[model samples]
Target: MTDHPYNEMPRSDDNQSLFRPVAVGGRGLPGNLALAPMAGATDGVFRAICREQGASLTCTELVSARGIRHDPGWARSWRYLAITPAEQPVAIQLFGADPDDFDYAVRAVLEHPVLSSAFAIDINMVCPVPKVVGTGAGSALMRDLPLAARVIRSAVAAASGYEVPVTVKFRTGWDAATADTPAFARMAEQSGAAMLMVHARTRDMMYAGQADWSVIARVKAAVSVPVFGNGDVRDGPSAVAMLRETGADGAAIGRGALGNPWVFAHAAAALRGEAPLPPPDVAARAQTALREVRERAANLGEARGVRESRKSLLWYLHGTPRAAETRRRAAVVESLKEVERLLADWESSFFDKNGAVHFT
Candidate 1:
């Protein structure tokens, strides 16, 4: 449906394999490619970078239900809470299981001026992280359909007087043998979710094996609301295949966009019937990384901002020609000057000769 061009495009009913602007809170979201709410990764600065590079929608890292109540300033103080004016339509994701706690979490989120202005409220019901599931939230919700539905309904009620749309992200159930994405999708839609995001993997997998796109297809078949497939979408072709193979409404990219913010833009272009553009060259990527640090530091203070950004720098340089050496240098980088020095020397070898990224 979207005109973006990938290496291989699949044909289907016009309604079935296309990119349509999803409207939340009566606003039209641009690209079909949405960023996943990866914990400690999808912070506000990173979200802005990806959005600038062309992500249609972005989500905040998962926040705890209890954390919000305990720390009234949690959302306000989080680096991800500092969104730029341009990255509108982003969603803040929250995780928790207790019905009362869930309600309290919603109230906390609504208190933030920036958060309440979001296009949608995303409920994270599918995170596979042990710390998250251990508390009966995240993937643990898969085992209790009734409770999960209640949580969703409670969140929806919090927005009763508002127009903000409610969306849910979930996995393929607790395990491979017991995949229940279809059932969950039905429950989410029936309970009031305007959108459903399927991660295509089970809680047990936990980033192990490849995501089962077939499961995504099944969820899409079972749900009338838009179904965005997530998992293993590290490139334009993969994004295209996920759409084709699963007939998903869109994609929710996570690790893939870490070092490669261009993924969002390239994927958007590919989806729009154009040849994919290459990622920035080493020099350009390094410059972008530096700019990101500066921007984040400006907003979050220098010391903590640069320190919090170390992992992302390593991600961008991962798999470059001299990645091992680059990673070695990045790991030891304690200051912005050190980061700049490392990228200065490694730029030539790590970046493509012609400045095109080859994710292959």
Candidate 2:
């Protein structure tokens, strides 16, 4: 273990806000680490947790542009775009193929009450999920450059009169084995993308195998906008390595932060050349799990939060002893009391040869 465990606490507001700020679309985000928007996760409460932990900014789960245009009241899509003051500098990411629908979605966001806090808007072009891909959206856009350009154009036009910065998050190409990501990155810039986040994988590759950082470097060299590298950035050193290796501007944390938001906290410190805090102990994990559940419950209400937080509660114990057994019990928990009991017991059993959740 490194001699310095990041145990850093809240510094003054002015100090934290200015620490290695990242520039996105002419605006400075508070830090360099951003939480990658997960489809089922990354709600308001979750976003807040990541920010509190040290992530400078975060994206909303991919909201469907077509769905929003078709039914503005669709709870699943538009509702995810919810932003708050504490989560300022948040970007709401949109997906879907219809350029007209994307226009509609952008207008809707600008007109919403939350418009004032909407930091930036991001377009999703890299998701490998089949349902999204089937819609000619997500990674499918990588293959259809013309349509991708059109949708991006629409988003840019819609936000043109406003101060909101428009961005894109996409994949390397349709094929991982033969990626032409640099061209795509240039296209995104020409199409008015103020910043770009590239998941260094191809469409066919899905989430398997390693992310190609070389593509990220190529993209960075080709574009003037800020480039945030995605895929395989699991911790501080890797985050730093991505920036160093690719010459990219920032690192967006995805599955690496599932159970450990501290990855963001540590990443913030690492980016600023400071020591990161130690990994959370078992007790910290249990408390955070409970706090997240309650916060989710508060934001999404009782039923939804309880249902949604179940997976997260289990995720919090990823490398703990008897994790497999506890994960099973966590899945079917009927009440908050049961969740409390399970986590409380798990907290008591934190002892292992090493203190961290992972042994590898």
For candidate 2, the TM-score is 0.89
Give Cα distance to truth, residue 67, candidate 2, Å: 1.2
Question: Model 1: runs farther than 4 Å from truth?
Answer: 1-17, 24-26, 75-77, 80-82, 348-360
lDDT of 1 by residue, 1-360 (tens): 333222123475443325557554355677589988787777777788888888889987777777776776775436544455667668878888987776787776677776777777788888887888889899899999999999999988886557677899998999877777788888998998988899888898888898999988888877677778898997787887788888777898898998788998777766665766966776778887887777767776878777877888888777766678888877767677787787776675544778664432
RMSD of each: 4.6, 6.9
Best by lDDT: 2
Question: Scored by CA lDDT, what does every candidate get?
Answer: 0.78, 0.80
Q: Could you tell me the C-alpha RMSD of candidate 1 in Å?
A: 4.6
